[model samples]
Target: MLHSRETYQPSPSFTQPEMITIILLYLLIALLASVVGSMAGLGGGIIIKPLLDFFNDYDLPTIGVLSAATVLAMATVSLIKLRISKVAIDRKNGFIIAFGSILGGFIGKWIFNFFVLEIGLEQLIGKIQASVLAILLLIIFIYIKFQKNMVTYQMKNKLGILLAGVLLGLIAAFLGIGGGPLNMALLIFFFSMDAKQASINSIYIIFFSQLSSLILVGTTTGFGSYDLSIIWYMILGGSIGGLIGSIFVQKLTSRRIERIFNIVIVIMILINIYNVVKG
Candidate 1:
């Protein structure tokens, strides 16, 4: 499951030169992944997991840690931009969902550490993860394309927002994803939020949830000893991508960006499924 030259601890068999090459690759992938994910409001989950799976021997919990680290950086950048841009967010709704997601993320970390580890549940979880990715990709594509006319939110959909928060939070914990995609979709489709507002609010929501997730995972999961440099590179690359994506988004239609995002997601998910099935 880990790379031969384990990222957390380099193997004696591999030279430093080889490790540097791997790190460079990781950086490149991070840039591309974040650009696609941030543009689409999916919080980078669709790409991060599969990329990690293919490149290293990271366990799920470690992936969770890395994911949290990267998302934290992106969220911080996004939050600062939103503040400067004076983007208005429905804080009442954003906070409520964030509260649920934060709690759910902690619970998720606990489940991953205690139950999944104790029962050796990685195999089952892997299969389920692959399946979920496939379904999510398909749904994202359909929602982005055909649902344009139907995609609208009602002011009265308060109950739906609460429900979405809890559900997405649970999923975030289990998958090490930021849960922004689902929440943003809900806000866009059910709350009548514009693209910019949804994006800004998602930044805050994901930030808090990831912070809470890190606390739980750190307390119980022990960091899995992955290379700290990988975390840094991922965050750095993701930040750069987020800045570019946010700027490009201001002048573009949501539908256009969504179409491009869906294509990348579908390809990644298909590759992920193929890997899981092969394994």
Candidate 2:
């Protein structure tokens, strides 16, 4: 159901060298996204989607598929590396949120297929996604800016965490992201978790969320709907980047990563705005 490379057909416009170069570019981007996403407790989609949009002419569904593949690779490799390095994954709470995220992914993908794909509402959906994401990212930035560390203020609210995961999963699937910004925000600001730990847990949450998304998209979009071969390039980069990022995560501080994360979000919002207006 996933990684169906059989459907890939490189376009006639590119020669062999050109195709290899483009694939290399995709790999590089995925690698960078995974590295940053891992350090910041995100699943790396926010970075991947816009860069993919800026560099290529692929449609949203194709982007969604590629984005899912990238996130899956990042999550898998990062989780493995972290586990081997003895990083705590917070299996208790992380799994609670992940389960909810899985359910939400199906719901999100159903909406995407039926409303956006089937009805051909790409423009409308894109606009809505851009607008909502811009607003949310801004809110997250402001919220984090003012909050002092209440690191020990424990939130054992299972229901709340689950609901948050559902929301994150739905948004991730709909927007073709790994819910990095949102997930990191949830862990760092609301739950009072440390940045490094939150980042690790964020990948865990994203792993299951993206898995559900790929399965759901495969069912709805069918095989060969997009160039499946491109996913291999992205996955390779994401895997390597994931392992690299996990190894370096302990050396960095959350505050520094948070600042960089917000900057990236602002830039992404600007890109989204430009796309919306240019449309």
lDDT string for model 2 (1-279, tens) is 323344433223557887788888888989998887777776788888877766654666778888888889888988888888887778988898898888888888778766665566776877776777777777876766665633434568889878878988888777777788778778776567766667878889999998888887667557465756678889888888888787778677877766766777778778767656664
RMSD of every candidate to native, in Å, equals 4.2, 3.6
Q: Which pairs clash inside model 1? A: 1-57, 2-57, 3-57, 153-190
lDDT of each: 0.68, 0.77
Angstrom error at residue 51, model 1? 1.6
- 1-279 in candidate 1: lDDT tens per residue? 222223234222436887688667767766776666666666665577777766655566566677777777666666666677676767888888888888777666666655445555766776677677677767756775565577475755566666667777878777767876666676777677655556667777887888888777566535545445567887897787667655655556766766665677678777778757765
Candidate 2 wrong stretches, greater than 4 Å: 1-18, 149-153
Q: Give the C-alpha miss distance for residue 232 in model 1, angstroms.
A: 1.6
Model 1: how large is the Cα RMSD against the reference?
4.2
User: The CA-based lDDT of model 2 is what?
Assistant: 0.77
User: Where is the poorest 10-residue window by lDDT in model 2?
Assistant: 2-11
